[model samples]
Target chain A: SQQGEEDPQALSIQEGENATMNCSYKTSINNLQWYRQNSGRGLVHLILIRSNEREKHSGRLRVTLDTSKKSSSLLITASRAADTASYFCATDETGGAQKLVFGQGTRLTINP
Target chain B: NAGVTQTPKFRVLKTGQSMTLLCAQDMNHEYMYWYRQDPGMGLRLIHYSVGEGTTAKGEVPDGYNVSRLKKQNFLLGLESAAPSQTSVYFCASRRPGTGRFYNEQFFGPGTRLTVL
Candidate 1:
């Protein structure tokens, strides 16, 4: 079963606009990581936010985690056509077994 | 360096047929995993190996089997193909990070399997 669920199953936006996606998980996590998948390709690691931390940034991507709510959000500023892809959030449970549970994912499209 | 690679990018199998998908990693990661992706289902774990010669079931282990005979290779096998087993399969490997935490996993290109 998927431990996380993403909101806005799909999103479409024009270039230069900001895009935001949210993910909610059921159990405590050691860390939450975001990944991106291009059409018909494997996923690429984007960014990882540790449980102890609340927010993280990399380039045009920003991620905020709220453990109290068991949810996280990914923000992409100034979206571009190339930024269009499926985004997924994976959680590593807070226990001995280090396995990642993934969410359904949000498909984002950036129109040029 | 070809972080991770999967064999047979695409395949079609008849119901009741069997096949094995191969996955390899060159990062010398100690952890390897197999996952299946279906439309609207993101991805679900099939099995995982923490080290060579050791394997464990994941969230979705039924209808699938896995083997990790080598540290850098993981294989997933379907004994009896079914229409419901048709999906995109992904293989990933990861190494432990500082403390007991783990680093991000590297995924293969994925293999598309179809059963009719």
Candidate 2:
């Protein structure tokens, strides 16, 4: 069974706009991670927010975690055409041997 | 240095044929994993290894086999290719720290496999 689910399966936005993606999970997690994947390519780790932390930021990326709601959101500011890719949220359970459970992902398209 | 690399960016196999996919990581990660991605489905883990010479089954491990004979290498094999196995395969590696939240998996360029 999938542990994480993302809302708005697809999104299209213009350049310089801000894009937000949401993910909701079932169980308590140690951390939530966001990754980006270009068409037919590998995934690049974007940001990681620990369970103890409510929010984190890295460059133009911001991640927020709400353990009470079992949800996380990723915000990319000033999006560009290069940002067109699929974004995924992965969760690691709260224990040893952190096995990742990934969400279905949100496909974002940035129109230049 | 190459982070994580998978060989044969694309492959085509016929029914009943067998093949193996190779994944190598230069980061000297202690953990490795194999996953398959079908359309609409996120990713399903096939097998994983915590260390060299050890392997464990993941969520969807019925038709796949894995080996981690070397510290920097992991292998995923298909005994008999089936059309249903056609999908994108990704290999990931990580050096998880002993902390509450340290799972960061680095993925390799996926292999697009097609079985007929």
RMSD to the true structure for each prediction, in A, is 1.2, 1.1
How many Å off is the CA of A108 in candidate 1? 0.3
| RMSD of candidate 2 to true structure, Å | 1.1
Report the lDDT tens digits of candidate 2 across residue range B11-111.
99999999999999999999999989987788878899989999998889988999999999999999999999999999999996645648689999999
TM-score of decoy 2: 0.97
Model 2: per-residue Cα lDDT over A1-112, one tens digit each = 6888998799999999999999999988888899898998988898889889999999999999999999999999999999999999988887635468888899999999
lDDT of 1 by residue, A1-111 (tens): 788899989999999999999999999888999999999999999999999999999999999999999999999999999999999999988863768899999999998
TM-score of each: 0.97, 0.97
Error of 2 at B2 (Å): 1.1
User: What is the alpha-carbon lDDT of model 1 when measured against the actual structure?
Assistant: 0.94
Off by over 4 Å in 1: B98-100
Query: What lDDT is obtained when candidate 2 is compared to the true structure?
Result: 0.91
True contacts kept of 2: 0.68
For each predicted model, how many residue pairs clash, with residues at least 3 apart or on different chains?
0, 0
Error of 1 at A54 (Å): 0.8
